[model samples]
Target chain A: MRTYGNSASVVVLLAWLLLPFATARAESIVLASTTSLDNSGLLGRILPAFTAKTGIEVRVVAQGTGQALATAARGDADLVLVHDPEAEAAFMAAGHGKTRVEIAWNDFLFVGPQSDRTAIGGMTDAVAALRLVSEAGAIFVSRGDNSGTDALEKRLWRAAGIVPAGQPWYRDIGGGMGAALNMAAALDGVTLTDRGTWLSFANRRGLVELVHGDARLINRYRVIELDSVRHAGAKLGPAHVLAAWLAGAEGQAAIGAFVLGGEVLFHPGVREIPPGE
Target chain B: MEEFVPIVLRSLAVSLAATGFAIAIGLPLAAALALGRWPGRPIVVVMVNALLGLPPVVVGLVLYLLLSRQGALGVLGWLFTPGAMVLAQTVLATPIVAALAHRAIEGRWRRYGPTMQAAGASRWRALPHLVRMAARGVATAVLAGFGRTVSEVGAVLVVGGNIAGFTRTMTTTITLETSKGNLDLALGIGLVLIGISVAVSATVLVLAGERR
Candidate 1:
């Protein structure tokens, strides 16, 4: 018993000794971002450049775009990098964001099993492809997580004039892009995923891109700083620096230069301002 | 693997600190429940035992709100930090430690109570003696608490935000790497986590054997 007591005390002492190392840090900013960007390894490739140049370490909390916006709305993050334009507009209009700037752009792709049961291969129109899948009752794995890709998928379904909620073929898996893709592979179903995450994803399990090159498939990423007036503790200085750096020449170059397996994932450009900006 | 060292060390530090805090708060509560004559002792015991099954994600959500900038405790700016992660883990671990320690200490208290009372020792006064006598059982309880915290990913993921090089732990890193489709790295981290659990359990068993 005495030996046990001594061991417990030693463990507790070591814990106390290492506690400070876990908490101490220099200048840093919390950036709530979408899982697609993080899964694509874009941030992993480009964030170090921003940190090295500005000496401000970026701690990214990757979630769905909806969750990322919600996190920033609650003042839990200094800034946000997400691709959901409608949700971003709602967040800014609700007075949660100080500034919003488009940083980079990617497009969503419809991917599924290589067998092409629905024969959506080489389809350029997403709405038409989705309608064909719905009519054929083919397995469709929906992200169902309120992510940017999920939002776009829902919009395409609406445009197709099909309500797929209660359909037996629509498998709504409330998960991330990669999870949705894995599910699609397992069930031999189809799912919508961004170009970035799809390119970097390794567990394809015989899944292949089936549909792309639609104008409606464009996914634009934006960086937004939290409103300092509402969130008094918001790290506006570093947030502003990071946001500006992302839209600046150096950051744009970094985004464009990030390539995976000989393919550029994202295009760096602010083609147009957000609605009501 | 070099990058993983810091993640593993941070996970150990965070979980250990939370377990230490839980033990600090739990042992006394356990002794009180086991030995003291209180009006609401049964209710307190039931509550603690029930809390043993508290969902970690709910705890994380509650702590996230309390620590958010818009919430009441926002002044501390602990959200998305290691401090918040520790608090969430402590909340998760305290009930396990207290309830299990209560069972261990209660048995020793019943066996040693009459002698201590005959020697004119109060219930509070006998706490240390009872705890020492029940050290092996209490150590087991502490190990259980440590194991729970070390293996938990839900609460830490929600509260710590899984920041790289900061709040990321072994379990959270596994979750992140899996989502990123880095199956090799994720499995490697998972193996390390299991190895740590095995090592700690073996150490405790060896110590218990020494007592015999």
Candidate 2:
């Protein structure tokens, strides 16, 4: 009787008292970014070096670009690393961000089943390819989460003068890029994705890159610090330090050096100027 | 396979810790609800049972607000940490624990109360003795709490931030892996989770059988 009752109570008490002690204590700063950037394993490659150099740990909260920007706007994150220049510009205009700097660049590649239902292979113009897919009645998966990729896809549809909404062939999945890609693979559907994620994603499920390398399909990543004045409680100093380090020479080199499956995922944004700036 | 070990272990550790805290706090609350005649005792019982139906994400969201930088407890700086995950799970599990524990102890309390009162025992004096008598059923309540906490993904992901090698847990990893099209890894982790849960349930069943 003593063994059963006392030991059970003792174990529970010890676990209750001792478990919090297991959590590690580290000075950390939060970085809200897109799932494409985080899921591509690029951050895992380069962040450790940054931490080694600065001893500042980065905690990444990966969501869609829109959600990431919203997190930064709420002062929930110290900084935001995301694509979608339009959203970034809007964030800056709203005075939520102190500064924005280009960190890296990748192109959007159209991926679909090798069956090529839309016959979009060898197409260099993304808008024309999208129009062809729409006209062909081929299934196209959209990352409907208001992500950078989703925004760009909408822009492409608008340029092609086609409303993909309400179409049976068009499915807007309100999820992350990786999820959209997975859905596309499962349905054997077409999708537009950042090259970094497309390259790093291992479960292709017979999907192939159908269209790529158009200037209109460029995906550029930028890091922005939340306005310190607006977010009085934010870790502004470390955020700025991390922003500078990311846009600096070392960071650019690290981005350029990151390779997956023998393919260079991103081109370091060393010399290229951001468009419409 | 190698990468999944830590995530599974983290999930177990967090859920177990949450269950431990839930039982510690919930058992006493349940005892009070069973034995005491308070003004709002019925409302409290109703509230506890209703809380068992509370969505984990809502709890996660509320806890997130309380733990965010601008939150009331933000000074502790536990947000986006493993500590935050445990806190969220405990908050989610406490009601389940209390509700089930109340049900378990209420029967024993009714049977024991009249006899103990006849023997000149106060409610407080009889509570400890009643809890000891209902220990087996209380153990089941604790197991149910553990199951609820471990299987939940919403709260832990929201509070833990799912940071790799830091706050990543089995359920969160399953969500991420499945979404990322890594079905094999997700399925593997899912199998392991089911195995562990089945093992816990089986152990409890065996213990109960032996007691019977």
Candidate 3:
């Protein structure tokens, strides 16, 4: 009505286009997580829900447990979801992570080919099974990648008081769980793997569960916020939110109920005794 | 990633070995095709061409089946070593090199094949000349194959197991870094890879040009 529909409207239109740019930008948090949780679809199922409810955008970068922790140390990621508690504690003590807490629990099992010459069948004891595998030189496959699974496997061997070097049948496969399992299956050998990924593997042609359900077979997962102190100055906003959300009840429940092949894959727990605790 | 530099270097060494082995296998075969005519030459050409598209994972799968502890080549026990990675890259690189070399030589062989014959040179006597002429193209093929071998993540990850301080290669390092969200390290490794590729390609081009 005031003849404002002239060329001045172009400036108004440009202002309209630019007005949204002045508002506060949503802070997107990057979470580096293990392949197990990501592959298990827990992140997929939970992230969308979290974003919808909280309006915080989340970007996930998934890999093996070791890589995730290493990434957090580099300050490239705000948070990490990983399973190797000992390593996570080391990271925390190193000041790479500000706060770390156990968010889930699972078990590691020895998988093997069905012709159980090691007689691992119906055996609930993992140490004994390992002893048999080692003594028999039964082509034991190792995830020699220094991954959490690999680290645990090495610990078990040491705990059992066995050194697995230069043994013809004791093979070191510096690979992922799937590759290690495949290596073992092809050889009909024995190897350690996380139950979640192993149970999820559809190509379990000749593989069978050998040793699980052992007290020592306990597997735990943790979420840690990257520490900027060690990093010499980095923003902790996303890291704080990510760690808080993971420790929150919703995050813990989301973890425990995550499934693989229609079976519950993880048992989340907020309370875990840290090393020397 | 800076963390995986040693790994990538080890993998680069393996790729070099694979390229060396593949060029050894491919050159003679390419030369033979350039000089000789066999009953199944057409069939051989088609086979080599088909092999150009061989998937690395498929090769990895086959090698895994063959070299796994219970498999046929298990006695070699090379399942997790840089050797296995070299073997897989060798297999993948051979066909590419052979095909490219053959294509390069065949076109020239038609023109130069009879010149030597006219000069009372037996086809066998013409071998050296043909090889000299094809050397530049063959060098390029070998360099390209090396590029492919060094940059591959799947086959090496499958065959070598991406073992830290062992069979870890540049490709696997990038993957490990990315998933770990160590973008700085990942970018560092990526830059190294690009640098290596550029330097190698330039060296090959210079060498090829000099020969021409």
State each model's CA lDDT, in order: 0.87, 0.84, 0.73
- What fraction of native interface contacts does model 1 preserve? 0.50
DockQ leaderboard ranking: 1, 2, 3
Clashing pairs in 3: A174-B161
Where does model 2 exceed 4 Å of error?
Answer: A1-26, A271-276, B1-3, B202-212
Q: Please tell me which predicted candidate would have the highest DockQ against the true structure.
A: 1
Per-residue lDDT for A19-61 in model 1, tens only?
5456544678889999888777888889998998888889999
True contacts kept of each: 0.50, 0.36, 0.00
Worst 10 residues of 1 chain A by lDDT: A16-25
Full-model lDDT, candidate 2: 0.84
* TM-scores for candidates 1 onward, in order: 0.94, 0.91, 0.55
Candidate 3 Cα deviation (angstroms), residue B51: 24
> DockQ of all candidates, in order?
0.51, 0.41, 0.02
Error of 2 at A268 (Å): 0.8
lDDT of 2 by residue, B1-212 (tens): 22777677778778887887898899889988888888999999999999988899998989888987778988887878778888998988899889888987898988888999999999898887777777778778888899999899999888888888767888998888887677898898899999999987776666655654
User: What range of 10 consecutive residues in model 3 chain A has the weakest lDDT sum?
Assistant: A13-22
Instruction: Identify the superior model by lDDT, candidate 1 or candidate 3.
Output: 1
lDDT of 3 at B68: 61
Please report the candidate that would top lDDT against the real structure. 1
Q: Which candidate is the best by TM-score?
A: 1
Q: lDDT for model 1, please.
A: 0.87
How many clashing pairs per prediction, in order? Answer: 0, 0, 1
Measure candidate 3: CA RMSD.
Answer: 16.9
